[model samples]
Target: MKKAEDAQRLLRTLSTEMPEGWKKDYAGVRNEYRQAMEDAARQAALEINQTDPEVIEQFKKLRDDLFSSLSNHQARWPVLLLSEQRSVEYRQSVQAFEAKHSEFVRFMRQST
Candidate 1:
């Protein structure tokens, strides 16, 4: 999660500092964010596989919600360079992802 946050922060900074060219200039940052998310998802899947069946069942909804939010957030990334409005939408998506992520974390803790 921290990795995701860091990547996102870097992206936010890039967008703010170089809104016109961030996507073309900092493609590496975008890749980093993508890689971090993919890594996190892979780790979560591994953990879910190791968790007890009943516990996993209880978290299915939460896990799905988090992924859904994440997908929405990712979908906004490409359009962020299009307009200020897209950037605003991207930020809102980030907030939604954060909320879903926190909810998922809380449920995971309870599952343990």
Candidate 2:
């Protein structure tokens, strides 16, 4: 019961902090990529004719490009986190924290 309560507390703290940490850690690059993607999506939406197959393909391409850009932006975080020299003793713990927090995040996203 005590362990369960501790785990629950940890989950709540982690679920909030992890995303905040990620935003703080990568806000500049992430926001830049997001802004670019949103701008391009908006422009494409205005010009795209959904009924035409060629236009539809172009929209798909735009989406893929956005995803690729975001993916590249996001993929840098783990490497940075792992190699961070400030906490040399806690690298394994950091990895574990990432895994656990990721699971919590995934569950929250799926549930909501």
Which model scores highest in lDDT?
A: 1
- TM-score per prediction, in order, is 0.59, 0.36
Give per-residue CA lDDT, model 2, range 1-112, as digits (tens).
Answer: 2332344355334434565454344444334534654554555565556577765665566455545533543464432453324354454444554454344333323322
True lDDT of residue 112, candidate 2: 26
Deviation from native of the Cα of residue 76 in model 1, angstroms: 4.6
lDDT of 1 by residue, 1-112 (tens): 5687687788777766766666675567766766676676556655664547766665677777877776666666664454445556666776788788778766655544
Report the C-alpha displacement of residue 23, candidate 2, in angstroms.
12
Clashing pairs in 2: none
Query: What lDDT score is found at residue 78 in candidate 2?
Result: 39
At residue 50, give the lDDT of candidate 1: 56
